[model samples]
Target: MGEFELIRHYFAAAPCAQGGVGVALGIGDDCALLDLPAGEQLAISTDTLVAGVHFPAVCDPLLLGQRALAVAVSDLAAMGATAIGFTLALTLPQVGAQWLAGFADGLGRMAARCAISLIGGDTTRGPLSITVTVFGRVPTGQALRRSGAQPGDLLCVGGFLGNAAGALPLVLGEREAAADVAGPLLEHYWSPVPQLQLGERLRGLATAALDISDGLLADCGHIAKASGVALQVNLAQVPVSAPLQAFLGREAALHAALTGGDDYVLAFTVPESALTTLAREVHVIGRVLEGQGVTLRDPQGQDITPVQRGYQHFRETP
Candidate 1:
């Protein structure tokens, strides 16, 4: 079959997730038609994963498919946007049918799960990198941003601090663990699920929002810097997974949770009055104080030193 046919059969149209909107034209058309629903403003984001850079080399194609899309879609989640559709730009050294099949399967599965569609994309020859530009829509002027946080709003995290950081030891062959632990760590590294539903729910509730891609402390610093307020995180309140605790020990675990990247969880802020209204698993880790730094607090709320900073573009090590 031709390239266009392959895309049409495998990667073109995906069923809507929440039935929020209908696609006027999905695939096999000169251009796609989308109806921007009333009261919603379109939110757009793009991300690229390079080979042996953002992800490990020789990983599962399916998992790679999942991770690539998840990371791109995460921007929408951070902004409290309901995912709509995405375009992909895939580069390959060679288009092996088996590889394309696996990649398409993985991408299709994720699109279905997220209720998104593959509106359009391009493919070419290269060293196997993927770029995804995803779009979602939320009510006008209500989508979350990094600058909305205030001095008195409470800071919270959606889930555990760092698993992707703790899992890297196994990914790089630098450390070993029991099979049970290894499996989960690798899973965390391979497949990161975007928190679309929770982010949508946080729209009006959260004063500001951003996802934890670049470590908790660093990402918090992002909110702090953007919102022009000092943000303090309490070490005692930071959540770490059991596998991370067993693998890295308490202090190192906290470091990974603080400086380690790729947790993909939502770290957002809401007024103190909304604290009790939070869902079952969400944790209120700190409060937005009148300051301009991302520091940690001891149990008594005194400042503690942070060991590592946020992710850097050129740094070889974190």
Candidate 2:
């Protein structure tokens, strides 16, 4: 099939195109249409994943499909937006039916789970890369942002950290791990669960919120910088999974949780008064302080921000 045909058959016609909640119209048109409730605003985010730089040069097409969409949608979750639809721009070295089939299947699975629809996009010839733009809806002026934090607010995280980072060695083929340890790690890396529900629940409760794509400390820095408040993170309170500790040991796991990126968990600031109102499980890591920048302190209160902040795209050698 030709380019347009390929997109139509494998993408626009996929299960994700079945018309989701906020999609007014999807695919087969000059532009897909989205609608927001009278008092709601639209949330949008874009992300790109390049082969070798983002993922292994040769990786499972299925997992890549899932990862690409999930990564983009995580932004919406950060804003406490309800997922609506997405557009995909795919670049392939060459067309292969098997690869496309697997990718479409994976994308469909994630779309169905998130209740998002595929809208419109493009496909082209080039090195392997995928760009996804996602849309979501949130009540006007109620969407979570990084600039609303206040002093004395409790800092919290949606779930465990460092599992995706712990999987990097196995993913790069530099190290080997047993199934019990590796399986969960790889799943965390490939299929990160976007905390959309939790983000929605936190809309009015969280003073400031963001999805932790970079390491927790690094992403927290973004919030601190945006909000103009100092954040003190308790190293002992950062959540790490038991499986990650078993595979990499507590020290390594701690390091991973501190500096390793791509966890995709949600981090937010909750007022001391609103803490009891949160219905979701979250680890209270620290509190917002009146100052500037992000500070990491061990149980004994020693400063230990990593010498390296986190992943810097062009700055860090791929």
Candidate 3:
């Protein structure tokens, strides 16, 4: 099949293609149409995932599809937006029916799960890469921003960290893990769940918020710089999962939680009052303070912001 034929059969016919919230028109059109609700603003973001760079070259196509869309949708979650629809631009070195079937199935399942429709996009010949542009809606003036943190706000994370990072060794074939440890960590890395509902709940509550793509310390620095406030992270307070600790020792687990990237969990700040009002379980890692930049404090009250903060694609050697 040609490009348009492939999209028509695989992507355009995916679940949620017929009707989705705010999507006026979907695929097979010059432009996909979206209708925002009254007093709501559109939130849009784009993310690109290259085969060897983002995932192993021989990774499962299904997981790749899920991860690619989830990564882009994470930005909407940080803005406390409700996902409406998405566009997929897929590039491939060559077409393979089995791979396309798995990829489409994964993408469609996630689109259904998120209640987002496939709008419009392009397919081209190139190295294997997937770029998803997601669109969501937030009430006017209520969208969360990284610049809203206040000095006295409390810092929190949606869930445990380091699982994705922990799975990297196994993914790269550098290490082998027992099934018990491998299953959960591999799931975390391949099929990350975007915190869309939690983000919506935090709209008026969190002072500053962003999904943790980079490590906690590096991403927190973004909030610190954008909000012009200092953030003090208590190293002991960072949430590390038991599985991660079991796979890697406490020290290594701590290292992953602090510096490992691709968690996709929301790291946010809320006022003391809002903290009490939070309905879900969240780890309070630290608090915001007057000043600028992020600092890590140990149990002894000594500053120990590790020399390595997180992953930087350009600066790091793979």
Q: Per-candidate TM vs. native?
A: 0.90, 0.94, 0.94
TM-score of 3: 0.94
After superposition, candidate 3 runs with Cα above 4 Å error: 1-4, 305-318
Cα lDDT tens digits, model 2, 124-174, are 889999999999999999999999999999999999999999999999999
Model 2 misses residue 254 by how many Å? 0.8
314, model 3: CA deviation in Å? 18
Model 1: lowest-lDDT 10 consecutive positions: 309-318
- Over 77-133, each residue of candidate 3 has an lDDT whose tens digit, in order, gives 999999999998999888888898899888877777777888988888889989999
Predict model 2's lDDT versus the native. Answer: 0.87
For candidate 2, the per-residue lDDT at 197 reads 95
- What do the candidate models score in CA lDDT, each in turn? 0.80, 0.87, 0.87
Q: What is the lDDT of residue 38 in candidate 3?
A: 96
Q: What lDDT would candidate 1 get against the real structure?
A: 0.80
Question: Candidate 3 at 81: error in angstroms?
Answer: 0.3
